[model samples]
Target: MNTLFTVSVRRISHVCTLKPYKETKWLMPYGNPTGIYVYNCVANQRVPVILSDPHIATWYSCGPTVYDSAHIGHASCYVKLDIIQRILKSFFNVNLVTAMGITDIDDKIIKRGLETNTHFTNIAKQYESEFWLDMNSLNIEKPLIITRVSEQIDCIASFVKKLIDSELAYVSKTGSVYFDTSKFPSYGKLSRMQDEGEPSDEEKKNKMDFAVWKGHKPGEPYWDVPWGSGRPGWHIECSAMVSKVFGSQLDFHAGGIDLRFPHHENEEAQSCAYHNSRQWANYWIHVGHLQVKGDTKMSKSLKNTISIPELLKTYSADTFRMACLTSNYRYSMEYTDAAMENAEEVLNKFKFFLKDAIVYINNNTATHPCQYKDSILKELQKVQDGNIEALKTDFDTATCINNMLNLISSTNKIIKNDSSGYYPVTVTLIVEYITGVLTKFGLKLQDGSQENIFSDMLIDTLVEFRHTVRLNALSKKDKELLNACDIVRDKMKSIKVQINDSNKTPSWVLIK
Candidate 1:
């Protein structure tokens, strides 16, 4: 069984400790696209963002095929959905639950099973475990409930029965139940496929023509259903799961842009056929693809993919989060060593600032009130307010995170140049606010290292243990050691105190 964790509003501090990812009131709400059409890989046409009712928002994301490990592109989709979920809870004050289902039943599983001469269930288990490990390493919160296609046969059959009774679905001679696209007039509305053009003749001939229930096939998983013994099609599996879990109406449905076509489009068509209603999702959000080097989709089929487990072994989870946040969820981004390096560098800088701030807080002697207390509070409010407003305008995460980085940069500068200690109130207010926000994003301010003591320890340990004696020392012994240790520590620990103490003498705050 998978472990689950929930955050109640009352546990504000406990929630604060999460890695730099949180839902704030100022984040985006569930609604229609307000301005500028985002590229919809589903409709193949850019549609205006339109949000329906906010109170009843729910989400569903198609999960990984447990036949393989997760890749960077998969991480991109999860990050986008995570961002959307954050906005929904923060802005609408609505209970937003996301169900990400695993495709544990598929040809891929069968093929792997046959190749390895292993039981299909064991194959699925092995790959699913690998996927879970990868997602956890990326700091992604598990979905509310993960439904598997094989475990949902009865639900799929019931939904298929509805389509059949409504005359929207028909079982062909092959014993496969398929949704007749011709019966649904708005067949391609979600992807705007009809507006662009109709499916060619060959596209319609296959009985899997948007297979709702696949009849028994050799060497594949099957379950007894009203229609026959078969497996559910990829798209039908989601509709049935959603219906079983949350019913027909959903607040939002999200997946990678690549799934907009036959996958998501067919899902909408079949789901609507079950209800015979117009409303499905209040808002449909699709995340752009993550490109490999040279602008190619990072997919396993192409043999050009970066597995999450391999990535975590090298870079920290926070590094991955930072990389994803650096790009807007709507835009396609290339994953390269350069981008990862930049994100790591920036994160390191923030860590350094946080360490300095912590030390400064601990070392402060004066009890004077902060001068710009109100001003700092006002700035924080602006950030909180502005970030929410920007997010509402189509989940502009780039703007949101940019605002956060700007605030971090400004706060750091203020801590470095504390000429007049009058603004202690302002300093405290800003520090508290930043810490709160960083907590939401799951980044914590690390502490517990003795500033002077650790400094002394480093000097003794480094000078005594290493053989480079009588090194060219330009400054005093203390200053020289501080500089050397600063390089060794890379300014990560020293910056914590800088944000908290403004009155300290202007000297090496433990390297840049």
Candidate 2:
């Protein structure tokens, strides 16, 4: 069966307990309220999602501006979004085509270029490359289409011209193009902005929308448009790119919570004004921001921001990912060095448990292994069965991972208590369960394209390496040979360091 169809069926099965839903169709996690679940939607500040059309799943996420290194805050949202897409494929088996637009042309790029006396395009490209490197290091699934703002200038110019013709936008005397927010009645619907009693002079008489094109400015990159050579504003680029790629309306729209204010609201306003409808997106998904420890928000200006590259130098990408997933998707993640270390400790423990399980299976392979009676397997199966329900309820990843961790810990406890010489061949199931959990969380236990090795191989590698070290120390009377052996050990250590640094590894038999 197709992967998408299989996952769709699982998602359908999860919600069948409520009202009878057709299995052939898939529902998105949005829509108007119905019955008791109406409040559940409000809790997340969205209506309950009943995907009447699973095929309605066109997804979009806001990408980086490419002016600087990506911060951990950005990484959190990107990784979480990637996991959402991956888990849908894994558990719900939904085939989703995800896209994000990179803002290679922006004010920030130009400003940084001016400060450094370099070309804006070069600066943007450099940062964009670094951003992708960081994302790859974290094993973030790349967006299917990474549309660049520089490449999409033609589309953006055409969009602005259409909006001008529709009387939804206009050019100022300075060639600055702005969206006519007043033309769109539901301008702040998505963010639900509160309106004061009466509009002030600027608010009432002026074009209320954000700038679509910021006419030519000093030392900034300029593009040819009907309104003259100028750059597009922060908000309008997304609207133009999304409209060109996914049509006028998208199935789902997402961004960091901070973008929900002026950026997304303005995009919604501009898009709807041009399209002439209240529907800009079928579902709006906003990820909460990551905060600095004990702070309300993380900001580069405040010097509280931690870049992905800097953090990766200290902890493995999986550990960082674990920290990201520990909090609810809708809640803020407060990152600190201590938090990451704690997550690494837990991950190391999980790895050790897996090692033990492997050892048990190897010890038990002697018997015919008829009826497998692993308590760990039973717990894992139960968790897998119920995880779908947790996912369907607004993608409750925190709960889902919690259930998985409980199973891992419980299984470890069971293995610890078992005194029987029958170490149980059912450990294979336990290893697989751990793999499933790790994979769903965007962590790959097995190295890519390489066949997995037996657990004994891992033990043997460490043991052999140790044995070689002792033998060389005792047998080699020459200090120079001892130094050479030490160099080899150092080289292996360096390889381990590099592997850990890049968050990459090939299929392996043993650590040696």
Worst 10-residue lDDT window, candidate 2: 34-43
When summed lDDT is taken over every stretch of 10 residues in candidate 1, the lowest stretch is 18-27
Q: For each candidate, how many residue pairs have backbone atoms clashing (under 3 Å)? A: 46, 8
Q: Candidate 1 on 1-512: residue-level lDDT in tens? A: 11111222122111121111111111122343334333444334343443344354567888888887788789878866775676556454556677988888888888998999998889888988888877776667788889988787778788888888988888867668878876766566655554224434333443235777777987677887766788877788888999888885765678887887878878877876686555455356778889987679889889988877677777777777777766778778888889889988876776676556545544346454232344545666799888767665566656766776777776666667666454433444345555544444544333334232233332332323211211322233556544543433332242332211112222223333
Candidate 2 local lDDT, 346-442, one digit each (tens): 7776777777876665553344322335465567668877777777666677777678678767666546664443424344545655665676778
- The per-residue C-alpha lDDT of model 2 at residue 233 equals 82
TM-scores for all candidates: the values are: 0.74, 0.76
lDDT of 1: 0.63
Error of 1 at 160 (Å): 1.4
Q: In order, what lDDT does every prediction score?
A: 0.63, 0.66
